[model samples]
Target: MKDFSAEITYKTSRSSGAGGQNVNKVETAVTAIWNVMESAVFRFDEKLRISEKLKNRINSEGLLQMTASESRTQVQNKKIVTEKMLDLVEKALFVPKKRLATKPSKGQIQKRIDNKKKLSEKKENRKFRF
Candidate 1:
């Protein structure tokens, strides 16, 4: 997992979901922001890869924001938000191995052609002779 200690910043706000009575009164939810531009963890290539993958998630200023308010307690919510942010960063940093281009096996190709021939024969039987 990529270390994101320097990459992340956090803020708190009132939670809007779940807890009924206490929800309105307490500011328990946490909003975590990871500023990609300021992070020392990402090398130039890694940064570019992350930026491209997270194009939709990042704001115009390039800050990735995550909010969690599941629990009524501020600390719990903070933990949730941080966990989510870390997961996002981990996913963004992951590099999928390149796939080798391959053609269908001869047997599989023959099977597909046979199926098409059978289907065409079935359709031909449905038509009426004029």
Candidate 2:
């Protein structure tokens, strides 16, 4: 739901993969770059969360870059890259629920011990004895 239009910039270049003859003639690849450090739309906490969650995507200058070249036309590629960037930011802002540690139930622990005993007895019975 965050508006990143003002903070995002796009760069286009000839797509190296797919598109056959059109790849050589037209620049279809779109790279959408968003500067997380300078973004006015996000609060300090949100920016910190995004930087920590998307550390691999963010470059040294704190720019999050996403590229798309699946479509033959530049406009389609631009739209795809833009959507990808937005999705990335949205995911980065998500907070995961804390996991609680719990001990195994008594019945479950007993079941495991019973299984181990059964396996040990079975193996002992298989041994060659005179």
Model 1 misplaced regions, further than 4 Å: 107-130
lDDT of residue 79 for candidate 1? 81
Candidate 2 lDDT over residue span 1-130, tens digit each: 8878767899999999876798899988899999998999999999999999999989999999989998989999898888888888999898899999999999999999999999999999999999
Error of 2 at 78 (Å): 0.6
Q: How far is candidate 1 from the true structure (C-alpha RMSD, Å)?
A: 3.1
lDDT of each: 0.84, 0.91
> Could you tell me every candidate's TM-score relative to the true structure?
0.75, 0.80
Best by lDDT: 2
- In model 2, state the lDDT of residue 27: 89
